[model samples]
Target: MKIVEKKNFKYVDYLWDEAKAATLEGNEVDLLLYRSNLLGTDLRITNYGGGNTSCRTVEKDPLTGEETGIMWIKGSGGDIGSLTRSGLAGLYVDKLRALKKVYRGIEHEDEMVALFNHCIYDLDSKAPSIDTPLHGLLPFKHIDHLHPDALIAVAAAKDSRKVTREIWGDSMGWVPWQRPGFDLGLQIEKCLAENPGIRGIVLGSHGLFTWGDTAYECYINSLEVIEMASEYIEKKIAGNGGVVFGGEKIKSLEPGKRKSQAAAIAPLLRGLCSSEKRMIGHFTDADRVLQYINSNDLERLAPMGTSCPDHFLRTKIQPLILPLEAGADLSDTTKLLGKLEPAFEQYRAEYREYYESCKHDNSPAIRDSNPVVILWPGVGMFTFAKNKQTARVASEFYVNAINVMRGAEAISEYTSLPRQEAFDIEYWLLEEAKLQRMPKEKPLSRKVALVTGATGGIGKAIADKLVEEGANVVLTDLDAELLKEAEGTYGKDEVSAVVCNVTGAADVEGAFRQACLGFGGVDIIVHSAGLAISKPLEETTEKDWQLLQDVLVKGQFLLAQSGVDIMRKQGLGGDIVSIASKNGLVAGPNNVGYGTAKAAQQHMTRLLAAELGPDKIRVNTVNPDGVIVGSKIWEGAWAEGRARAYGITVEELPAHYAKRNLLHEIIRPEDIANGVYALLGILDKSTGNTINVDGGMANAFVR
Candidate 1:
């Protein structure tokens, strides 16, 4: 981690400009956007995907069987920040253009992916970029590409043409931003034909697309255009005079708790490239405090995500508001989704209608407009995707995207492309296939995770998430009805549910045996079922302590040993995630047996990590605070009574625990679920540690 001086910043900036400028010097031009095309290939622009860059090369040589010219682009999985010459892959430009013309008789994405995968590249370092075809349609040699907020703001707005007319006027052309791929190339070609001598193009609701005769020209044009839009927005917004009055205060959520919340949110924000680290803002200022507490403006302002296109991919339209009764804290998964899923439907219906009215031709429906991302109150935005990579990417883009939109909207109304126009780009045939053809990795897909007490609150959610990732899952619980309900929830054959008393060694062993028989071999295990009995030392019984131990400590040991045995046989280290609780760290008023059992659970979690480290198995514990509020535990008035007896409202209880830390977020089942997922090699880094699931609880320190 290093910081460059403000003065030094210009040089790095100039270097990218120079690189883009240098490309056009030898009749070889790299788009100026390639210079600093995207922030990085992390959780920013393209998820775990690489951003693209290219130059037009004349393959019109008379040597052998020379055919057509090509668009050389950044290969798959390469980052845009440090793009080298070898990073770009070459594709026949004419062939790419041909893809769009045959609209009715177009190829599905899978076929095209297969075709490109076979295309010869200079080397492995250069794989085909996802946007190669889109680049081919633009005649300019140096084109700069980026999903800049300044540009996206204009794109997502309703009157892109009107907005551009007010700014650059005749100097630029406003094309409704479409999804990136071949269809967009065709659209660009058609639009270009309509207007000659256009150097810059604004894709509504997406980003800015600009090209120039030279890299410097292209770079200058991009900077000028972005600054113009951003400057205009700044000027207008300053006049609006944002929310005023004294800034509200927020309680702190601690470092360990902050990390847990980030982990909890990581899975949902898969497509958006964001790090789980942003959950550390336990102590923010007035604006954050206001936005944190009151989400009334979310629908009118940040609804369905950014007003424009790419933001839709990341933020997914809007944030789920925290219910009033939630007491400014969210602890249950159901309350979060109970509020989340309905709004999603409202947007989905509109989506279906948008496609129905202006469907140009039969395109195999746009990727399940199922809304890829979600933002929750208390918890930061959660981008939903099948994998961690997708979620992180979505979250990163969304944070900045949302911030920029909020700022820009303050100045003027946000506008964007009409529904039909947005659809064409989203379902672009060429881009769709390019992604499908990517080589698959075996480290994750096909791996199995057996989660104990998985039919319960936290365990059930974790099992569901893993199944979403295409993992083989074995769901076990002592409650047959709960497990049966879980079987219904997950769909038949996707997961196997077995009734087992984990405290009984044979029952635990039998469940493992059954899972092995069902899914071949197991690679990950999560021990989550436990008892939390809160009573005074005076009222405590020997049976109470024993009951807690039988369920919490004993269950975790038996499950981990079984997972270890199965993993060893498969010649791979397995992952073991134990769901501990906040009581483990901080003692509450009368939770004697519960607190002791939880503390013991944490020790066992660490001991397993140390023992399994030698065998390559990674073990970690997820200690969540205030999660019972959203679980069946709360439905039965257990959490409510617990909160009442403690002299606090149930709403205040989660925050009492959360405000004790740095990030003031309540622990949710999904948060605990996400932490377990991280330990299971979803991140593929670090080993042997206990990660908290509290939203920044201050003193529950574990190292």
Candidate 2:
């Protein structure tokens, strides 16, 4: 075994651990995983899920008692950095190579995907990616196909072949742009055959391919190729007086201002982009993103789109750039917002035209015409998708594109894949099939819900249920510690925590803003925050009355006002469910202050429902009589006061309340949560209505 010395590369990190490799010396698959993880650690090397790695190993054949060559490659939709053993597709090497004999041509290449299952060496291996042939057909023990930003810069340049020769001489080969499939794999094999001594190949407007006899050598070869490209690009950028993308055209807003502005416009932009289907948004004001969007060449270069298939696939063919005057003040959010609708409209129109011009007979129906990447000159970039992680990954890929553009433009004229070729890959039937194979999205998929008092039992139950149903939730409450705990309970990607005193206007507004920034705005609002003070008319003090009114009535009012404003701006009809009490309608004794507030909450739901009908915002109430289990409200003075009024011990309050209802059933927090879910998912058509979860409380029934 050759121990390759780690070179201190200026541009890319050499992260291969010799000690780690030693532990897996006999296991080529483990070595491949080690190499893959090292290469994927840096975005400069590869964006998430944008690269593939493979290693050919000898394993005992299941049928014969003989060793057979098996090739393990990164599975479809797998990210190298986080890949597990199951994420690799394992196939018989001989079986894969035999595919070449049956290959008809590029036009009929998609059929080969279905045939890949026949080549599977491991029954439980993940589905193979389109690039499987590229790895398997190559006559190397280890192979790496990467979309490093620096290498892509060289590959996407106008004179990519010339640049490749200049950078690596005859040691590297170049193949013309061909969509990844059997033919392109054949092209690479021919290129290597012609240049017998070449160490790697650069696919024009695609990416880099490097191979070695061992996994460690393969990893080194890839790093060396990318480092050389990075160094050459860096020197050229310096020679060009540090100016790239034709230099800066607009200055970036201050960091704080950029974030505030991004948060302010995210919901509206998300709504506009979501006209076809709802989209979650991710925002970034990173320096590289700012540099690209602020550049003079942004207008010319951005429209060309990304050359890498992995990039443009995630970012879309091209981003929708907001038109801003060269030196306009970006702090004027009102003015900036005015430009969004027209820009989005124009983008959609152009995208539709692009589709019409480029569609093949079997092309998948036009996907959401909305741009995945949205660029604002001074603020930064916003990327939207079905969920937060995808949105964020799209944003990251665009940043990779920006880096590629910067390097290419500095050294040579950057070029994008031709529109027709881009369309072919974007609408590839194999890609569409993979999409169709995905598990069905949950009913509340893409919906963002803001649940108040989410740390409390009812509130937490609602938040958990919403998440389970595929809605991203923002958990807000006065208890910071509990909010943090709840946030962890639900993963951060699906749940955001914000401490809010709903009665405070600033707190309410700020929480909504955070929700917009975190998950692209609120689609469902649950006013579950409340405290109870069970008191008779004689014992109820002005202080107690005021407190109940402030928390129950005023809190609901503030949350509703803010939620309504955001929902209206979104232009996506929304649901607002208030956790009111049955006492409000039943007119029970020893509940003057609390009952009045609950009545106020119930009526407010109806009023908002009537007012927001045109906007399609539904308002409803869930009235629960006695939710004792896991309820913070029941653990305190309120429970004691209610128990005293009913002439029962505090411990017996649950039985007393349950028996009081007609059906004699106990109401739990989860039951309240179910009611909220019903109003949002099942009873979506019914609004301004109250659903009592109090075991058939006849007195509380709404007329």
Candidate 3:
């Protein structure tokens, strides 16, 4: 057994931990999982959910108490980095090998997938991935199929086989591009037979495959191959004399300027990309991304598309590039905005053409023609998807593609897969079947919501509910610490916290900007930030009245003003729900200041509804009678003033208010949240109408 010498790595990190491996000495499957985790977690090794690993282990057969060969491989749609034992599909090796005898050729390879289920060793294991043959048909005890950018650069080069020989000589084998299936697996097996003593094979315009007798040896083989490729590409890149991408036609914008520019145009780009369905966006101005988009060859190379199947699948066939001249003014948002729609439309038209030209008799209908990725010179790259994680992962994949192009172009002319081949993989019926198997999207899926006063009871409840329904939420409040605490309650991908004083114009604008950067843009706005000043007519000072108006009325106005601007730019209609008080309509005593502000908020909803009808922006109000439980207002002097006015103790406010309502039901913050959710999700058509969630307060009814 000849061991390959490990070279010192420069571009990729060597993360193998012998100490950790020792703990799983007896469990070969656990060791394989450990190796998979170390490889998958690093974007340099492979992308998210883009690679597969397998170990052929001897396990006791459940039917017969005898040891049998079982190949444990990554299941469908599982990310290797976060893969669990249950995520591995265990299939009988003998059965999998037997199916090869019945293989009917490349055209009938997809039928082989259904047979894989019959080979499952564990009835409860996850469904097998399409690339199972690439791992199962191999002779080695352990195998790895990865899509590292460095290796893919060599694989996607114009003279890929020649480059493979130059880099690894006869030590590594080379195979031509073949879509993943039984046929590709046979080609790999044949490559190994023809080239004895080869450590791995680079699949043309695809990825890399390596194998070993032991799990540890397979891990080392995979790392060594990637590291050597990285070293070779880096040397070639350096020899190019800093003239990669035809020598940077446009300089990168400064960090601050680029991000601000990204924030400025993200909503517009998001809107354009969301023509089919609403999308969440992820933006990146990383040096590598900026270098590619700002380069002279961007126009020439971007349209050729990515070579790897995993790469193009996430990014689409090509990205929509926003053309900007050298030394272009990024500050003139109007000019940048003007160029967006035309470019977007052209991209869509080209996508439709590609689909029409390449469709087969059984091809799935064309997917969204809207580009998943959009690149702007000097600014950066923007990727949109159904959710934040997918959007962010798409950006990461494009960056990987950029690195691949950089390496390939340095060594040789980069070559993408042929249009027909790319289209076949993109619209494969199996791929469509996988998509159909996906769980139904939640009601609020792809919608981004911004909730003001999010740290408060009603605000927090509304934010939580929105997230539960699949909406990414931006939680804003005046208190930074509370906002941080509130954000911690939800996953970072689902919620973002911004400290904002809604009364300040700059603060409101800045909050919206953060929301745009965080989750593309806002589709729903909830104005729940307010304070109460319950004072008798004589006792109410000018200061009290102004304070209430500023916090309640003025704050709601500022949020609406900023939110509407983003919604209009998105070209997607939006929802604005204000949490007003029943006092606004009831005109109760000792609540002059609070009642006046509430009335203003309620009327503002109606007025905005009438004005924003043309834009499809709905405005409504949720008037609560007495949300005394779990409410911040009840914790302050407002409770004391209300209690004094009602001639009752503060402790009795909940029971007293609940009894006064028609249903005698105490209103909780969640009840108010449900009202807001109903307005946004179910009663979407009803605008300028008040839905009184305060135990059916008759006085607050809209007549």
Candidate 4:
């Protein structure tokens, strides 16, 4: 509850001075940049994208040297913390206020948006936030509106105005809950005029607003109010045995056991929430989360909505509570599905009823009502979003909200905005319009892929192809350093790299855990890790024979079993494409070690297809031949010896083998990648089947 100056306060003060100096040195609003970052970096003050900061300043026209007052407020799509000058939209102050004189029609959210854009002083600036008018109309040099959880704990309660009075006295003004738009801005303008002495205002069920002549004054006011609210909750909830998670007495599972449990549970939740289309799920069970899910009052409190209104768009009002607890018997997978099916159906029915009751004629179209957060007794919380980044962001915000709600309920009755208010924000036209503007998704958008041996050749090609097609790809390889390098090959936003020796159980297990952590879960697996050895049967050493079998045969065995385990949990059918060599079909001279292992890999594909078919997992193979140019297996002595046997120079061996095929063309790594892409089913269905990328080898062709 205390707001003590940190040891680094002096350094922060120095930065503030520099920000002021930067403002005087020709940079527009550098002080606001420094001020926003100061608030944005502290989660206790505001979570990501949950707060806004603004300033009223004069900008001199470069051409005419005319000075005009402008209102610079946090723009849409900019995080308040780490905000820069460009992150704030600069609108002409006089022109913005002038709109009220001519604005006489029924106010619509979309129309208000257009008016805000039209008032922009600099058309090149970012789009103004929907709350631009609130900041613009306020008669102050600086303004900050933050959705701090401690303050929201007070704002979201039923008797919030009374509670806020108890903590803030008359220093803060009060405004009833109102959606952000033209009318709400006018209400605030009137409220502030009537209570001109108040230093700050708390918007019921919304957020806190503070104004001052300088950034530091408004920032300090925010801190003092937040501290008062924190103290109030602390004193009220003190020693009340608030919410206690039931698992406090349970021993923590070992790391290995914990990872396996997570891998098992993530896909099941992903499957239950998913349909034929894919949705990513991120699972976490921090100690606090486990305790909250196991709390004695969970049944009474867990069904309630978020702690504040800002989260309504990201997390639906209420979460879906699965009947099963965490650490339950996962051995009976089929039995688990049976229970989930009914629970999910009931949740859907309730969502429909809630939406139907509050929907208005002009409300934007309803989104999928499936709960975004799920509370399972043992598994903690599972958050779902269209992509991995969004799911994780929503997950963090919900976790924070849970703690805030618990604190509030422990002290007094916990409540949230009514259903109508929730529906209005959830389907608000301004937010809906943002979604409408998104471009058509790539074919594999929302899907995840894992490609093995991805540092070189066919493995790298497959990973690149998946990412290009809109899938989030996890690249795994035997070389740890190489994997790190490959991680950056694709944009960091969509690709991750992991070092996985396919032959090791721990490595394979770790790889799956990484995929789950990085992108929720995997939908497609490209198994391309292999070893090549060439020698006469009698001359093949035991080491060479063992290495080939370990990587080629045993590796596929491990990956297939693990891949199927995860895909089955997801309930969504999956595709597994293993890269096999033509040598597997047509044995080449002096290649016993490589051919035997590849042949086994090919048959393993068929066997896995048959075993996993019941779970709707498709196992298939892509047979690529004459991919000699990029492959390390065809380099150095191996290339020289193969070329000698073909009676051609090493550089000509590729051409010689390519012409020997019926099609008389070389098979490139991308060609093999294309074959793998086909089995992924973006265009057509082909599974438990083999597609040859071998330039039509007559002898190697499968009937």
Candidate 5:
């Protein structure tokens, strides 16, 4: 429970040096950056973008030697771990603090936002954190505000005041739950004025605020406070068996079984969670998460409230407890999918009622009523968000809350702010306004897509375009190594790669299942997997024809059928774009196998379009010509053979082919990708049609 000394910490020197180099004029800004980064680097202290830090420093006018006191604080929506000079915004200290004196109660959100922005030292600087005024009113030179999990255990407890005294012994001041804004700032300033002896403040059901003359002191204070709270909980919960109440001991969810269940159930939940505004679900069977969600009293204890009020902004007040049996139906995907919608509907109805009960005339617009965090029996838990990072962020905080609640309950009964307070924090002007600051989502922001042959030129280009248009992609390819590389390029969340042999039913089905697991369900399918062969009628080998038919023809058929099944289960009409070739429309010597397979694939697209049109599913094709760049198919033997057939060297193939076309431009993979994207969703009413991407080849103009 002791503070980590500066000499004992290994990274302190490197961090301090880095902070000093980033400072403007090498002042206390170095201290602000150093201390803030130290606090942020530890997930035990604060999660991503969850806390704020500030310093009261002198801003020297370079032109005039006049020194003005300016408050430099963490800017809104900036992460503290990678914070730099730009992450810290400077505001006129007097102007910020003067609001305490001149403020009449301004209850409107816009008016308060305007007032805060007006106090900035310069409009050009990044916007100050909403908690800027709280730091300004405090007399300390340096301030650290953090939402440490251990602190939440104590601050969110029913006997928070008693626990606060037991942990810090009057060293910290206590304030009841108040949503973060001007009123909260005034209340904090009042608490400090009332308790002049306290060095820090414990915000009930919120976070901790500590300050010092030196940066090291403020940082150490937070560490020491957190360590003490952590120790207190550890001791209280020492040798505690699973909560045994009324002579019934909570059973353990066997780790091995829980993990298997989580993997099996995740895909179904993912598919169920998918909607018009797409959400990606992530599965976790972390020991802490399982221990809590599977506990005997979860039905009574879990839904009380969040571990802290601040978390309500991210995780809502409580998680949706999915009605999943512990052992039965754990591995049944169809059963889980069948039950998912009803469970979600019930959760939504209850959430809406909760909102209605607590809302006032001036409440902000309600966010998604669906619970972001879902907990089940042996399946552990799932978190759904717009993307993986956000889902992970929520999961991390939720895990922290679980540990905090475990500690609080071990000590005594765990409790948080009442419904009204929780509602206030959720709809508070400053917190709600953060949503408005987020960048606008693209049209396909919540949609998911699955693409075959995604490691190759046209396939990879199509995947990238879909991502740029705001769709989450599931990429399938025959080359496992190449698919892995492609997956790494777009980060963990945007694209997932599955090694798939499209001609094999098992592989195709597995690929579709993976698409469901990765992004709930596939809304758009681009079947780009194909093979080409060069052989004249006389030289054509049966083996060459079989290979072409297997990959170019059979592959499309398998992928289209599997993807359509997923779309049908989702009950959302989807787009299926087949990447047929320009060769399909035009006959050429030594290209019989390829041209024939492609022609059959195009015909299959038409059949699929006619069959699925009744179900509102659209089918289309993109016929791309000689795309040489990023094409492994054209770079080796195929390049030499095509060049030889055209009576030219391989080096002249690109320009020679380009000139034969009306536009005289060499078609790139991106050109084919654009056509594919247009067919997928952009051309909403267009289906059973081929969009040629051949730079204007009249012979390949769908004749």
Candidate 6:
């Protein structure tokens, strides 16, 4: 929210003019390059990555004047600092525009899985930016989107709309946040259908988005809208403005001094940059710059974090809050590094805790997080990279966030992201796909897996983990949450979680229909979902036996039945992970329905492996006895069931089970996920096989 300092404002306007002029001259490449650089400058005065700028070029058909209209989209993976023209992919404009016109359909579960794959393009990097088409929808050649901290402060607030409405009036349109891509594009197209010549859009609970016939016009419109918003809010607060003053009337350092400083700083870092050293400029004293230095509550006043989600390519997460106290020393660079080291540690720890709680595998360890870069207070930010490209990308984001923070305090506050959603986006499939496309260390990418009771716990884990390994996964469970969560991870494209009462004949038929839609056919289905109940012979009810039969017997037959059909169609073989207890292999006292059902489930798996050998699906079961964490088979259920047979307390159970396993290690859900991946990827050709994901418990089953 801080007003641009008169001096700094001039610098900003200068860069803006230079960028706009380039675009006005019909230099698309220069337009993009200029905006990218100006945007970097603007970001330094705000919070990290507080905003982004994009340009849409209308490429035409070779023979016709009509628009072939291919859009060279900013490929999703690269940061703007080092964003390369080569990374831009030509999107078929007609197809995307047509997609924008369609209404959202009530899609089938498996159908959604198929659709997610279709979203990819020949660029074959990560999925295209969900907003690529949205940007293309704008007729303007240039678009500027900002999460100006000041604007968001007033905007993200409950009454932000009133403030924005008061400021923007009929000048801009507003849209609510929806799932990005087709649905969102449809909504935007609907709105634009009515207001064809609109200039900008202010997304509710999001940020300011501006557009123009040219890049300069776009940048100016954005500045005008933001300035008006800032002025309106400043007056509404009943103050002329936050009164502030200049720095130590430090004699206007000569232009010669500016050149010397810019020269010194550029060379110090240029050796680390990728490509050749390009343009270099330095900011001298500016009015907003002074306001930024003198602004009160520097800590809380800064933009919350990012100006926009896309801004991550520029300003990272947070900025180094420089102390502008009178007589303060700006030369003490080490002090800035000292304050950051601890905060970085805390950030990594929180990140680790989040990873462990969500990651299905305990097998693959956490990555190093020493700090992507450092924020040096008065000196601005510096990136840490063995190479210049990454270091500069880090620096670009660092500055953008700072500028966003600078603007944010004026309006009120700009929200970054909610904690959980941040984690989801931070690890989103579109984000993860970049890693997936890279040559993997192991040859597991093409594996296909079938996981049962995949709607929850062990089954879901096995299913999702398989997808990360570059495998297509089929998950079966009666719960819809499995699909919801899985879709949240794999975008409903690479992973399918179906609701099937595995006990029913018709339902199993439906599950295979889903698999066909998911990956064209089936390769693996882990019969991981089943149930357990405990009671002595007299206490056990007939209802328990009936329920158990539906799952352990009938359900197995139906699921195996459908899978065989798909495997036959596929002709290529697959793997099946059946989760059975140690009691099924041998016997545990008082174990009635579960022991019998698992015994039946295993025999059926072997039976299918035998029957389907000609079609090529390998059927197997991971007989894990006591892997309690993250499986549908809850410890309480296992405890009560085990105690019924042994007459022991539930509290004494983990210990009791540990006594039976040879390795004395608890079977984690990750261990089960590992087993699922292993079974699918292993070269073993044998069918009707069993892998004991259990840590040596099968050896202890002497009976």
On lDDT, the leading prediction is 2
lDDT of each: 0.59, 0.90, 0.89, 0.77, 0.77, 0.54
| Candidate 4 TM-score versus the reference | 0.87
Residues 462-577, candidate 5, lDDT per residue (tens digit)? 99999988888989998888988898889657888888998899998888777655555678888888666666778788988898899888888888887777677666678889
Ten contiguous residues with the weakest lDDT in model 2: 324-333
User: What stretches of model 3 exceed 4 Å from their correct place?
Assistant: 1-8, 325-338, 537-541
* Pairs with backbone N, CA or C atoms under 3 Å apart (clashes), candidate 5: 270-520, 278-446
Better candidate number, 1 or 5, judged by TM-score: 5
1 against 2, candidate with superior TM-score? 2
| Clash pairs detected, candidate 2 | none
Q: Which stretches of candidate 6 lie over 4 Å from their true place?
A: 1-444, 635-638, 698-703
Model 4 alpha-carbon miss at residue 422, Å: 0.6
Clashes of 4: 5
The Cα RMSD of model 3 versus the native structure comes to 2.3
Could you say which candidate leads in TM-score? 3
Q: After superposition, which runs of candidate 5 have C-alpha atoms over 4 Å from their true positions?
A: 1-27, 61-65, 105-111, 239-276, 326-338, 430-432, 478-481
Q: Could you give candidate 1's per-residue lDDT for residues 1-703 as a string of tens digits?
A: 1112212221113234344344455545344235444334322232223334455666663445675676666666565666666666766666665655544423443344444544443444365655666677787666666655666666655566788878887777777755555566667777778878776777766666777655556556655676677667666655655441112223335434433443332222221111212110111112343353335445455443454444454444344432333223334544544654565566667656766775657565544555544444433434444333444555555555555555445535555344444555455555456567776744356466788878777888888788776676778888899888888877544677889888998888777665544444566788887656667778788998899999998888888776676565444556887788777888777788888888888888777777878777887777787785445555544565577667888777766756656787666788887887777756555566678877766677674
Off by over 4 Å in 1: 1-52, 58-70, 75-79, 82-87, 92-134, 177-187, 190-196, 242-296, 302-309, 314-319, 322-372, 415-703
RMSD for each model, in Å, please?
A: 18.5, 2.4, 2.3, 4.2, 3.7, 24.9
The residue pairs in collision within model 4 are 40-81, 245-291, 271-570, 326-378, 326-379
**How far out, in Å, is residue 350 in model 6?**
57
Candidate 2: lDDT of 630? Answer: 89
Task: Answer with 5 or 6, whichever has the higher TM-score.
Answer: 5
* Per-model TM values vs. the true structure: 0.50, 0.94, 0.96, 0.87, 0.90, 0.42
Better of 1 and 5 by lDDT: 5
What is candidate 4's lDDT per residue for 272-389, written digit by digit as tens? 7775357887777777676677666667767778756667678788888878655677777889888887888888788888878888897766567677898776556788888776
